[model samples]
Target: MTTQATLTPAKELAAKNRARFPNESAEYRQARNALLAEEIELRRHIERVAERRRQLPPGGEVTKDYRFEGENGPVALADLFGDKDTLIIYSYMFGPEREKPCPMCTSLMASWEGKVPDIEQRVALAMVARSPIERLVAAKKARGWRQLKVYSDSDGSFTRDYVSADDADVPAYTVFTRRDGTIRHFWSAEMSSEMADPGQDPRDAPDPDPLWTLLDTTPEGRGANWYPKLEYPSAG
Candidate 1:
């Protein structure tokens, strides 16, 4: 454990940064250095939050054997873990009533599709929905996702219990851990629209979506009105 007093100050480290661009102005450099210091502090804060999450006391034990329909056949919550002890389930907003899935959810899933294999190296990952498995599989095929595993919470039991009691079509990210024959609820991204700042949208800290992260680095940032779409006019 590195002590705070012994660690180099973020501002000092930022000052030592030698990165320079061609024809950069002094005012820009000064402002950028200050921003860099803040970024460094933000990184440290993120790590601290992660460590605190890791130290959290054991979560509630999962008693119900939630069932889901996978691409091939039926599977239980425990079976989702596969060979890993930790399982991450992303419940996207794809229910029976909607003709198309939620654009935001689809965007996030698209970003995660390619990284599924890399992510599974440490924990099992599954994309789940309340629609039928066939519909979910069709969506997966349409998206051209090769590695991401899709499943259907056919009965909406899992969604009602963990995601929303009203069973509203919403996206949720939940993690469960299996150890010593016991599966327990783990950390979840609980931040919602209600918790967001006045101008910002609901999002988790150290956001899992790379799109937003990338946009945040730009001058426009993530615009208030703009959002992802299932099909773009320019995509063709």
Candidate 2:
């Protein structure tokens, strides 16, 4: 770990950046350099938060043998770990009562679908819903997602315990760690939409969604009214 005393100041590092655009004004350069310094500090802050998360004490042991319905057949929570010691389960808002899934959850899942294989190399990943196994599989096929491993918490046992007590159609991200054949809850994204700031939407630090992250770089930023949808009209 690098101490703050030994690390160079973000502003000093930004001063060394000589990047220039054609015919750009001096004011633009000065502002950009200032923003660059802030960005550097943001990166350092992210690392510090990650380190703190990794140092968290061991969580509660998962006593119940929760089961889920996978594409192939029934599977237990322990089985989802495969050969990895860590497992990440994303509870998407696709309850049996709803005809379609939540657009926000869909957008997040779509972004992760392509990276599933790469992610599985380090830790097991599962996309779970409160709908039946058949319904979940159908949705996966409709979306043309080949890599994401969809599952169904058919009985809602896992959903009620880890996601929502009322079994509401909400998205959740939970992580579990397996050590010595015992499964334990490691961490979860507990921040809910109700926790959002006055102007900003509820979101976690180092958000997992690439869509919002990409939008953040634009001048317009992630607008208050704009949101992702299940489908968009074809472009001419």
Candidate 3:
């Protein structure tokens, strides 16, 4: 692998960036330039991580033909793949005990609803919850999410096997591949709170949600006490 030093230095690339803002101080520009170099390196690191993920060998074969209760009716694990060879499933933290769906998961899905059509062109995407199908559908309708496909893992077999063995109210993002006549696990967001750095939230490297990405560019940077809510009262 080519090192950043061997290739063009991130500092040099950042130095070449002629972008400027109105009335920015020289000190700010200096600090911004330094930050830009780090951003360049971060971009490179992200690309490397993605390459490593793509290079991963075939994971465990999915032996269990897990069943799910879709809005339409019952569906199998293979049915979620549809015509695509790759499938991405988000195990929502909407278990029966919770009064409402997870706010973080809901925020992520709200962003995903619009991109579903474009994303489904290459890979199938589904959001599965341990709640009943009727409940999941109701929440979907209430949220005005039309593009995302929601499924209910009524038996908890799929959630137990792939998500949490104890049926914990934790969300999981897993990818699976269906090639030829067999299906196998691809990759999963295994990073947990235990692996997180001090003061940093447990999140995947290439975050699936746009909320964090957008906030990261701002000074506040995902406030510690702030979190998405199921519903917000109308300003009107």
Ranking by TM-score: 2, 1, 3
Where does model 2 exceed 4 Å of error? 1-5
* Best-performing candidate as measured by TM-score: 2
**Which residue runs of candidate 1 sit more than 4 Å off their true CA positions?**
1-5, 234-236
Query: Model 3 RMSD to the real structure?
Result: 1.9
Candidate with maximal lDDT:
2
Candidate 3 on 1-236: residue-level lDDT in tens?
54334668899999998989999999999999999999998988887888789999999999997999999999999999999999999999899999899999999999999999999999999999999999999999999989999999999998988889898989999999999979999999999899998987888878888999999889899889899888899999
Candidates 2 and 3, the one with greater TM-score: 2
Q: Say which prediction, candidate 1 or candidate 2, comes out ahead on TM-score.
A: 2
Counting clashing residue pairs in each candidate, in order, gives 0, 0, 0
lDDT of each: 0.92, 0.94, 0.92
lDDT of 1 at 122: 100
Query: TM-score for all predictions?
Result: 0.96, 0.97, 0.95
Lowest lDDT sum, 10 consecutive residues, model 2, at: 1-10
lDDT of 2: 0.94
- Residue pair clashes in candidate 1: none
lDDT of 1 by residue, 185-210 (tens): 98888998899999888898888989
- For model 3 the TM-score comes to 0.95
